[model samples]
Target chain A: MLTAHKIKVFQSLDKKKFRQKYNLFLVEGNKTIKEIPNSHFKIREIFSLDPSEIPTGDFDTTKITPKDLKKISFLQHPKDSVAVCELGEEKFLANLPIQIVLDGIQDPGNLGTIIRLADWFGIPQIICSEDTVDLYNPKVIQASMGSFLRVNVVYRDLVEYLTHSDAAKIGTDMDGENLYHHKFPEKFNLILGNEGNGMRPETERLLTEKITIPRFGKSTESLNVSMATGIILGQIFSHKG
Target chain B: MLTAHKIKVFQSLDKKKFRQKYNLFLVEGNKTIKEIPNSHFKIREIFSLDPSEIPTGDFDTTKITPKDLKKISFLQHPKDSVAVCELGEEKFLANLPIQIVLDGIQDPGNLGTIIRLADWFGIPQIICSEDTVDLYNPKVIQASMGSFLRVNVVYRDLVEYLTHSDAAKIGTDMDGENLYHHKFPEKFNLILGNEGNGMRPETERLLTEKITIPRFGKSTESLNVSMATGIILGQIFSHKG
Candidate 1:
């Protein structure tokens, strides 16, 4: 029988406060869970209906029924398993290369995709607004495809972060400089905004420059936030080489 | 009263054979429906739970109960409206500055996202394998966000299409040239494979040159197929500028 303490602790990890209190984040789905054993992250426990496929490790685990698993899963239909890993605090940014600031991207899929973008370009850190979705959101973890393990995402007020960074602060906007014409800075923070709203007006003031991708047609005024990140990152990294 | 003939047509559009036979496809949600008004294609019908917002037009419309809409909607929960469209056969590549080829992309969402990416970068046409998810699949239409309106997508045997192109034949692969170091051709047909299993061995043989994204970490073997397309396109467009 599962004790109330374990169940309650399992439930609390979903919130940022609980994740902070315990220094843990949940990774869900059998495939995502399996990848954990291979990761550098320290696993706290495995909560699942079956443990046969999971590797035998030093990590603590509690066998729970499928119904018990469902109660905590973010998916409408829960996967066979989920694992908890210690959340690493963001390390000091080494001046090595390109940096990204997620202004207020709210979708977990978009955030994860952005993190995956960062991992591909070898970007070291992504600073996020407190309003941005939690990096620990299971959906973000799933979409990231283990990239979350590598990329450092720190949450703080983006405006404050932008204000402090000596790196060029570039904001993506429809009315900004055409990306084709603009020269990229070697050291800079690329700020991409929310899907619905590009960037807050205050965030706009913080930008050292604003860049735009020319519209191919007006049918859709802009690309999806995540796609824009991929496009921008590609441009920035290609310039580096 | 809804006639059996109309129901037959609607039901048939769901299957590829019927869609091919009649050259019909599906679109969903209000934004897409509205976007179609400005598109070059013709509409077959509007099926909606709410008749109040639908425009008066020559197209046939059936009032569907919300319960009935769920039966036809590809989404777990149905959108407010869905429509059938006559897939237009227009060859926009009278001349090709740039082209995209999709090799057996099975997922409709990824295909749609790629299509949207092409539209954003102003790439002219997309060539897909006959096995690719239909351009008119509701999931593709919804995800494309009206890109199908401006962009032309063609279906052919990918091996034949690559062999026949006067432009450069580019394929992305794991063992190929690093995208950053490789010299990019001015006019080329960029081919992308499916999500998990990449280009067929036969398909890989025809590639003029294969290219790979240099991943930063050991564990991340690949990017999501859609993400790969975005990264590649971003590089392509940035170079053209």
Candidate 2:
């Protein structure tokens, strides 16, 4: 059973300001919550329709009815469990082989999918523009399918981040060199831009190489940013191997 | 101006049965509606907040307020125009070199993203299991980003389709041969499975080859079906190049 006050706090975590204030975010669904035990993230609390479904952990879990779960769930169809987790300490790697940079990526689903892609390809860190969707957004967390637990996503001024990095800056463009032909460096930051627009002008200026996933069909304006990330990362990592 | 009767008709297109009955589907947003002119699809009618925004074409267009568009739009944030387009004839290639086969892919967004990916890789034809989300789904159309105009998506019974096909059949799995090392034949059907459960048992039985995108990171149970599709397609096509 959840107290009225507790429900408010869980609901408040949905917003960025509250998530920042509390330094916690909600992870819903059985698949995502199940991953929490193995992840480095600290568990604050767990609310579940079936307490048995909640993974045995150090965290406190409250058994709640489906109606109660629905009240606090951001998902349309609330899952078996929802867990409140502390936003783990940001451990930015001093030097990384391949880093992903997002320039003004706005969609939560896109951001989440990219984080999952980053995890799949062993890309550890993602640097997002300050304007990118909040990492804690429920949709991002849901779409990531627990990948948010693995990838380190940090939001910063992309221009400043690019300027400070010694790594080769690569960004995708419609007219850039075909990705298949372009040999990626041992260490590089591959920047993907906004869904509607490519990289921002400031970020574009810092790019040492502009690469493109060559389009074979005439009608496709652009691949979804997440899909583009997956394709590019697959090519780069596969080629290196 | 959209009459109540017309609004009812447009809203009905949101359902798969109604879309089939009318032989038309909604194409919302300025970007998608703009693509209709260049596409092979026949436009039934165009509704726009500003009629001038509708490209000069042979189709009949009506000027409607944003509120009218919202009533008829499947999108949460309605775009300027929503055009009704005929469900154009599916031109199945008799002997295709590379084709995409979807096995019970249910998510509209995933299906849409896959269609767009197929377009990007120059895969001209997509064969979807009857259980897959309808190709005419509004969310599929929205997420495809106009790739729906170029790619041919057809629905059929997977068992029958696979049994009849002479092309080599490939499916993805966690323990299958590493995709990077697998050699794809010129004429083959690349099968992507359902989001949660991968290829159905029946479909799995049909696969001549089961390939896996080697995962470099731990804790990720699976990639989102669409991202996996993008990564696998990118590797296969790039390797051939």
Candidate 3:
């Protein structure tokens, strides 16, 4: 029961330019949609295979067949529902206790997992280099597992942000001080780098301390960016606790 | 040039049954192939788009076009080289310090990342439930980076294995002891469960201790299985240190 015009609009939202121009992004799957009611993001509209499966909200929702849902879905196996959501306004936490800064993180899944990790450790916000993957990328949203609802992800010039920040800057590297022995300050900006390369040279220059998670075994040259983020965040939380 | 018959054999190795029947698996990408020299696994043969890109090894190497490599490759964008390697012989560590036991882990990527995490923390071996994804799945190989070369992954009945082992059994759960404060034993079995479900009820019964990474923020229901594994392993290593 989807019109051609409607399908075109839904498909366009998948791209970054369209999402930016319209200020709307797609949130697919029943599980992810359920979280929208409690989130600050406003639901613009929804298309669902089962109307009952759609969470109760004031937003306009249309019932459609699974076949019809697939036509506009970004997922290979489209979930029972897909909702269009307006981008939430960014809240600048000036005195945030701990902030995570990402430098040119290319992988959407890695970015999403880092966002989820930041949420688990109660890190309020994530500041990404402008070149990092789009915050609303479908893969990123899916991997975030609804933590995107709680964490504020803002893209900015990471070099400028780090250079101006007064909080201690911690950058992860292979040849830095051992993570286990290093003590994190009361307030710090934990910077994670790209998948292939570590932090950018410009961002690296601004770091106050460089920390390394010692490799206990051979063969692994480096940990995945997201896994490193989780391990580093875990160490920081344990230290603070 | 890859023969039509040989290409069929290589393509078949993408499946679990084919890998078991032939006792061979595919290792794609330049970075992963470089690790095979240091690994215990034997290389059957390698096909590379550029012969110069192939690492110097005792194994037989064949020059092939990128188009030919794609025909036999399991990856969407096949890497420069693909090496067909024999499965390594399993080493039975009778008194392993810390063994990671996976129960019904479905995703190849999650299993691979967990293997990488185990390697990082110096966990010697991983025991997977019989129903878990095959260790030789090409996706697993890609996600594990090259950690699959160092870590030993064995498939078995998780419940039976845990019940028979004298090592303290620690299972991760939602409502459990805070991981930050809990003490990990010198010899222990750390069990992680499926991506969607935490642990099978039967496997749950075998656990001697249940530990959790406390949720510091609201809205995040759970952590990705691999991310959780990394965080837990990080805490365990820190505790040991």
Candidate 2 per-residue lDDT over residues A1-241, each given as its tens digit? 5899988988998889999998889999877888777778889889988888778888789998889999899999998988889988877775898989999999998998888888877788899999999999999998888899889998889899899999999999888998989988988999999999888898999999999887776754778788888888889878655
Ranking by lDDT: 2, 3, 1
Predicted complex 2: DockQ: 0.69
Show the colliding residue pairs in model 1.
Answer: none
What digit string (tens of lDDT, one per residue) describes model 3 on residues A1-241? 4689878887898789998888999999888898888878999889998878787778888998888899889989888898989988877777687989999999998998888887777887899999999999988998888889988999889888888899999999878899999988888998999888888899999989999988887745688888888888888888656
Instruction: Specify the CAPRI tier of model 3.
Output: medium
* Worst 10-residue lDDT window, candidate 1 chain B: B213-222
Predict model 2's lDDT versus the native: 0.87
Q: DockQ score of candidate 1?
A: 0.43
Score residue A101 of candidate 3 by CA lDDT. Answer: 91
What does each candidate score in C-alpha RMSD? Answer: 3.7, 1.8, 1.6
Q: Give model 1's docking category.
A: acceptable
For model 1, residues A68-168, the per-residue Cα lDDT tens digits are 88766667788888787887656656564577888788999999988888877787678888889999877798789888877788888877777777889
| Model 2 agreement with the true structure over B90-175: per-residue lDDT tens digits | 77776888889999999998999898888888888899998999999999998888898888899889999999999999999888
Candidate 2 vs. true structure, TM-score: 0.95
